[model samples]
Target: MKWNSSHKAAGQHVHQPGDKHAHAAGDGHNHTHGGIFGKNTELIFSLICGGLIGIGFGLSFIDGIPPLVSMIFYITAYFFGGYFTAKEAAQTIARGGFEIDFLMFVAAIGAAILGSWVEGALLLFLFSLGHALEHFAMEKARKSIAALTELAPKTALRKDGNGTNEVPIEALRKGDVIVVRPNTKIAADGVVVKGSSSVNQAPITGESIPVDKEPAPEGSFKIEETGKLDDKYRVFAGTINGNDLLEIQVSKEASDSTLSRLVQLVNEAQTQKSPTQQFTDRFERFFVPAVLILVVLLCFAFLVVDETFSTSFYRAMSVLVAASPCALAISTPSAVLSGVARAARAGVLIKGGRPLEDLGSLTAIAFDKTGTLTEGKPKLTKIMPLKTDVTEVQLLKIVVAVETLSDHPIAKAIVRDGKEKLGGEDLPAAHDMEAVLGKGIKAALGNDAIFAGNLALFESLDESKPSAEIVAVVRKAEQEGHTTMLIRRNQEYIGMIAVMDTPRAEAKGALEALQREGIRKMIMLTGDNQAVAEAIAAQTGITEARGGLLPEQKVEAVTQLAQQEGKVAMVGDGVNDAPAMARSTVGIAMGAAGSDVALETADIALMGDKLSLLPFAIGLSRHAKKIIQQNLIVSLGMVAILIPLTILGIATIGPAVVAHEGSTLIVVFNALRLLAYQGK
Candidate 1:
């Protein structure tokens, strides 16, 4: 074949349009079926090629072996090393496209024509080895992401009336009861209806400790209740159930399981590019083709300067091998793939490359106060009865009557305490109950008009106004950050109750960690009044607190922060945080396992309802960012030095190929290091 005639006619890269190239910088192509060996084809074939090359090189130094036989050994090694590269290069050329592998094939053929058979064989062998090792390393990272599918068992034990049948997870429907035995994964997200046990939730929440699982509130299973435990009644798919038995009533179909959605998002995230990667892609688009043209121009330029065409061609080939952007192309994708896989395993879902890099660049953060810095549950902190005749317990009973019929958070808190205090005692229910907007409620307690609400409920009655002493106490409670509600019965001031949402135990430490990580500011926003917001802010390490803010006001506060500080991130409890989160540079949703809105809306999600993971996510992102910069510096630096040296005849074809392929291998291995990263 007249290779030069065809090369002149083509003048472009040779690659099929739809070919799935898997490696970074586009040199690593396709995560296809393993080559000759099982799941180790590329590496194994490279080793075999290396063995033949070593034997061929050794035969030249020996006397007995004929030169013809020695040539045969080199030819066999070339066949093994160049087979896939040639196939891909041929396909690329046929499709009217060009690739780095195609350039590599031309360089190898150039070496063969120059009668440097050993040098050419070595070049092909080393080039193939780099691609093979890169393919293997990237597969390891990709498999880490794919491993999410394996966490759940293929089938679940569906409980029938007489016995249990093993059914595929796809067949499981909502409300279907399934029995989970010891040391097995829970097949669906559901509530436990029977039995008790401890379940390890690391796969779903990254929590290493096992949590105790209890029966549901209305579950008919007979077992002694042991007060309250966090997430006691809930069991999610992909978590390991400990010793003892549990029968779960599925809350969602298998397709909607937490693990399924997590896997789906992660797989989609791999396709999303970061800014650095996008820049590299644009650079490679022009760079690869330019290198080919430069090599062709340099070949003729060298021929005019040198005495022989062979010498000029060899130098151009050396420059061609040196100029290949093997390392530059693979750097970002290698690091990104590894980092994403590591994060998913730890239960931090960084949506894609853009958000992963954005997280590392955030300067300030705004937090939604409810269910974020503070435990969302309101507690009945104090109960004070105003009437001289009504004791605290007697007043609680009257309050419980109206509260029991309501499902408001404050009502639930008051009812739980009242029911616990008055042991097994029946109380009269409030009839003709009606709620007052933003103030309180009014009800008929056996025809005696009972009004139990805030101070506004008594504003219309100057004749039934409370004494000065009672009003003073209620006003004092408000300053201390308590949400106060006053009760009145038939124009008489009965009492006042205070409820407060306490700060989470780990909130302060998490905020401090963010400050240490170079986050300049942290703000808390909520609907509570300024005093209550400030109280919680002081308990935590928030830089500023804005309260009495409606949903729209929260968005305004986030926007103001973004203008003042570059790259502001909004951390929210998932649902209400959407508006404010949209205003910030990045939206972070915590407690994703429970919120569909959080998983779909936030750029990043802390799967568990833990504030501690926020600091970890940012720390891990910074580490990944650092690794990416290091890889770029090394890859570009090698190409810069090697290209000039090869063209100047200071380095030959063998050494140039060695250095180029060596740097490519180094960057890939460096990216895989993200798997070992641990955030405190």
Candidate 2:
């Protein structure tokens, strides 16, 4: 009954080791009854002790039965209920000095020795009940981390040339081909050699639509027509393959897949300690020992000042128990768990508490121009014929023919445009087709040579002859905020293709929200030229822009921002953004689709490439941190006040124990407030 309804439903189907439900259904009444017995142990013991004490008082009035027999029964009930807790506390103290457990044990034992048997039994029962509740609360918080481990399939269906074989996901090797059925989760990262399907990539990319996919023939599938499928595409893991049976060649093993890498990254993030946790750890180093010494001093002062030994010992024990700092110990973990759950519900998958803690302090955010700020999908914006003899159709025909063999987004845009303008014609065979990273491509089409790419790709060829016309076209496209790729046939510039990376529909609002949170300095870093980057930045409300940056240059830009500001966050999505993401204070990956590097290297992943979530994540982190501070303050203050009150004899041992346990309950409830964090 303590389990949330959703959690109980999820537990019904999946059975994992150490899972609470693993024993819950079978024991059913046994476990519940056992819990009841545990709760009543102290109450039952207290009632017996109280009855014996009352009998002793009554025997004195009756003058028949002896008081010694009643006293003996009282001792038996007191020891029976409180002995285990005291022993456990003593064991805890012997192992590592002292903790709340040790303090509670000492207080219960001291109360019994002082002839307050009923009070001792009640304290033990209440403490045990409170501990059980805390345990349940902590378990619920850990569900998110446990959920990650649950995503990996137990076994994978491996496809061999002869037939299919069932193999554990752990046994999978590199280059193993796997077949995925419709609506089934892709088990590994791979290239599709055969098949066409519309894949629902929402699990990974955060996009709701199912993207069209086809076999990557030749090198990769090229989108031949704009907004239409021509039967060529590939799908990756974390994607739901839709309504089509497709054969895919596994490129990476199960262990090396995007999901596996994401798990590893999240595990690493969970292990990394936040700044606040570090401070608490340092404080505990001295705080624990200092509190112990204070307890000893209180005892010594009472003994030297003519107070009875029993009174002094009991008072000292109460002070020690009340000031043990159990609430402080639970504060960080409670807040972190609540924050993580809140983030997951909002579609922001934060790997751990460290990033959540650091997010509030982010001063500058360096975003990748394409994919992060602009919509990653490029569109055919313009086409210009450079040579007087060349027609737009003629140039597009050759460009599409070569680009049809490539799977890059830019290549797809070129092919899509060409298919529409030139119509489907038998394409000439392109030999030795090679793509230059961050540049253009070169291929041999029979006896002629073809060169297509950015301006840098044509640096080796003479440009003066074609400079006037090419510059005019490039400038015209740039002024129109389009990225232009020049086309050349045997050193003569024939035509130019213009592509546009549109600013995301939600980018302006997301940026404004960040600005309101005091993050005023927003910058864009991209491989595109200054003109294209600036134009896109302007539209997104970004004032500073750096363009024409390589992968290394992006890292440098992030590093420079970090040096200039107190904290810098990088938001990007691409294999090229890995270095920059790793170098920033907090790295946020956008549209985490099939990019393993983006998911692994970035600290936070926005499942869908919604720019609006960036500000929301920052705001959520700030709110979570505030809750943590409040919990810590309330917890520590309670201990401070109770410890003094116990030492000053203003509060008895029974009230002190109640106050200490109550503070823990209050701090826990305060931390749970993080689950309600909603971004403004």
Candidate 3:
């Protein structure tokens, strides 16, 4: 009897990305029945074995057919059907443990010894066929992630000052402009510098509709005097461009593309087992041996009750077949793999089964306010003309020119807005611009002295300051929790521009969805002032707001949240949220595309800037957990019911095999149901 080492090697082996076949390698069962070319070799083997069984049984029924001929067919069927089973059982026994395969193999041998060759062959055939079917079923989940790597184009049409050439994706470097032809897949992550088109980003981002692609936002272009411009309208690799042509400037190398990272993360995710899976592995380690001992004890106990030795042994074999934890071992990985695949397809990257399980039990979700709850940057929301002489446009012109020489975030926001409104309209250049430490700017705009600053700067200036009415207006704007800048021209107030870090359009709705999903607490933590934090929280429906938090304070807040609320999920862009996320129960990074830090740091990266995916992920985690529970119940329930029935002479070897394999198939199909779960 030659035991197989090949199947044991395949069981422990893991398939890497770009492997030709989706190895059926990740079920809790320590065995594989994978096939080549995405076909199940085990299924083919079972078919051949079944053919032998059918021939052997039919030959025995034929008149004048020798019993020896029928016996030969049955023996060949046994070898063909039981080879892998025997090998798997032998390998496990050598390791001083056993699994479902051992139980089924011993049961079949016991039946054959009792002169019930047909029943024994039937048991092996069903058990092998069930495992083969499991391989085919689990393959769909594996392919869902493996298929992601194939979405990207392997070659890019690189165009530069010299000419156009088709280059391998690996040859492309950052800042290289690649011409994406009409109706083709974009080969790299980048921004569009020329031409415009719509591109389907569903492959990478799980967005259903095609997004319009153009140069960066209208006013976002960085226009230097040297004619240098910033690329615009973010484009990801593996997305399909529409009929219009696009010239994309590659932003990342082939390996660092968002699509590649997503695939890499998903492949690693499948290997990290869930808590339930770990428990099953431990359970099987002890339970299999205990089942074998119980079978031995049953045979002895039955013999002591005056039963015939052969009869007692036959019943013990049936009990062994009934008690094996075939379904129990497979319960978690099957469902977890399918859940992970579904999440990847939906633009949610769940790191592994551990996080997937952890996310479901979360009671608090701590959000980093600046980028997580609000549209990260400040936008000019209001322009008030305090002085009647200057038009709103002229006031903005003075502000844009005066602030051009200053290096401040508020200054950049003003310039961006001015570019949108002014549109190439050259303005008076400011000279002798002096930045007032913390106040604002004082400069000379073509002989007319200009001062664009907050109220503090104006209050400090005795002669060059606004009237009380203008001062009152600025104070009112400040009371509204906005960054109000008072513009003054030679002691007369021109106007005021109010900037606010507004909440994202999707923030309110996404938070509401989380609340509905049983999230008990939604807190906002920011380094901004309390007024600004409260303002954003009011709009976004967050349950609590904590402002003026330093990086360490954010971590402290997360720790407090975890202690008070139980499990906390910290949501932020991975860059600033790393500390807080590390302290929380689970860390989720938003807008993970184009952010390597987010990809590497966060436990779950909501691939794009879609906040809706968070709720979708929580919904998925809860559902996957539920499926795992259902599978465990069905598996353990079958064991509980089948053992007593088999021990009492209610089931023979054939019926016992049917019942055991039927439960295994039931749990498998149940776990695969996670694929169809569309999250809310």
Candidate 4:
């Protein structure tokens, strides 16, 4: 996984000119001011001012109070509600800029001048209310990053020659040994040197259950290592340790731990603007000034048509109120933020809004076979003995001993099965076990020189041949999508072992869900033989399966799929698939619970091993995009409709203000709905 740290680098621009609008929206999450009143206080004060305006409007309708006192109430309402907005407008103008704030201020003040003081106050209050809600929604998005910060442990137990000492995590260095207590969070990314435990990885991987971790036996070989630390022998910061003491060798600095990186990525992703936001900003750059000019022209036209000056000006103010693009400016960011937050909660880490949008538009998705569609661990299926004075158990013991030092998946499966079947009986240790990469293993056990591997390994040996029955069994096993290893003892064919990996339980449903969500194409890519790949594909309901692919071949296949199918997301959990993942439209890493590389490289990361979140994430993105489109239509549509109505004397200042500000509220509420999406 290649992390894009440039996005999180200090001094990268996070300052937006219109940032002041955050307060008006009633965003009360964090207050920058070290003052007594925070955003909640500000929101309450504004709401009280709004009530004052309501009272002032009510007084005008009663026969008791003087009109002068009613006017004072309206003036006070306008002052309090519009105070921050007017101040922001002045600041923007001083900077030689104009934005949505300036547009709202101009429209409100113009209404007040035309003797529609109550309408002006109402406009300010509604606009502030919308701003407050938008800020609150955006705050939820930012909280995802804060949640990551909360996951990291503040201190660690460092072991030295003298004794164990508690030290701040920041003071710890790579290669330091730390003692982690049971039930405590890990303080750094490290490997286990001693002890074992079940680790709760929910904070990082979103796995609800705790994963058991044990040290790998020294000198045991493993197949398909993934170039990543195995959870059995590794520990990470932020994961809760189970009831066992552990001695860990720190492999990375505290600042460079996986939890820190997650926080940085989320921070940068939030600050990065999407294309829709960029376009809206560009439109507002010119649209705000253009609306001001159009209002002046429309008012003059009304005056020339024998309308009273005050009435014409009043019509112009109404048009101005309707034309502000507050809703449009907020549409995409609010939806993007909400979608990202929802994804985080579901254990999917989306890099940013751009990927979220791309995920929504994906036409196809390609999956890597191993550890993705199938349980990555292969299991022993059958054993066939060709010629033997040798019993099945005897041959199995010999094979396990010979394959003991091999780190291949098939070897591990054999060793695992041997332990289960043989019941703790110690086998004769094989010496001088030589591994022939991609073929098999050779070893000397007691007197006989044992050979175990593929048909290619046998063919490479001098005059070593399996009998006809053995060849038939091998063919049947290969045809049935099982990997077969020919076992030979002292230049004689002895027997064979068949192993196979099964499809994951959720594979079928997850694929169908993707299809239901409008993914037009799905393909499985694997390095296994055609029969093995095809068998898993058939069971999982994938439409196409490609086999015998090298790392580069997978990359080529992904590139072709992206061109033919348009926008493809490749999902995998191996280092071999990284190139292919990078070549696709969106690269998704699955079960990336502790892999820093997978977390950093993939555009979309599924933290847990389950495929269930894939459909949920895609559905969320689509829904968010739909809401943004709805908001744009409503914002632009209102301007088209209300402008004509106000100019023709069919609508007044008060109604136009309500409709315009109400559109912003509608957009915000629609975006907020994403927070409740549980994924269909």
Alpha-carbon RMSD to native, per candidate: 13.7, 13.0, 12.5, 10.2
lDDT of 4 by residue, 1-680 (tens): 11111111121233222110111111111222111356454455468678999898888889977999889998898877777667667776776777677787787787787777776787677656545543433333333434456667788889989799889999998778899898899998777777866776544543222455766565442222312655567666888887778887787788887667555533432333344545665776788888888888877875568877667777787788777665665666567667778888998877655567767888899998877888776788777777758788887888888888765556877899877888888888999988765577888998999999888787777786776777788987888788889999897887888888778899999999999999989999886768888888889999999986755577678778876866778887754455455455566788553244444445677877778789998999888888878878888887788878887889887788778778877887888898899877
| Candidate 3 ranges with C-alpha deviation above 4 Å | 1-275, 278-286, 299-317, 424-426, 459-472, 475-481, 593-595
User: 42 in model 4: Cα distance from truth in Å?
Assistant: 17
Per-residue C-alpha lDDT of model 3 across residues 1-680, encoded as one tens digit per residue: 00000011122223322111122343444455654523677778777888998998998989998999988888888887787788788777776776667776876777677666776776677667756654444333344243456668889999967789999999998878899999899999887878877676544432222456676554454322112332127787878887678987787788987667655443432323345655665776777778788889878865578787777887887787678666665566567668778888998876555567778888789998765777766788778887678788888888888888875657778889887888888887888988764467889998688887777887778866677777788877776668888877776777899888778899999999998899989998876667778888888999898876644577678777776877778787633354455445576877643134333445677777788888988998899899888989998999889888988889876687777778878987997888898876
Q: How many backbone clashes does candidate 1 have?
A: 12
* lDDT (Cα atoms) of all candidates against the true structure: 0.69, 0.64, 0.70, 0.70
lDDT of 2 by residue, 602-647 (tens): 6678876677898888998888888778888987899889977988
* Residue 207 Cα positional deviation in candidate 2, in Å, after optimal superposition: 22
List TM-scores for all candidates, in order. 0.59, 0.57, 0.61, 0.59
What's the CA RMSD of model 1 in angstroms?
13.7
Ranking by lDDT: 3, 4, 1, 2
| Model 1: lowest-lDDT 10 consecutive positions | 1-10
How high is the lDDT of residue 470 in model 1? 79
Model 3: lowest-lDDT 10 consecutive positions: 1-10
Candidate 3 vs candidate 4, TM-score winner: 3
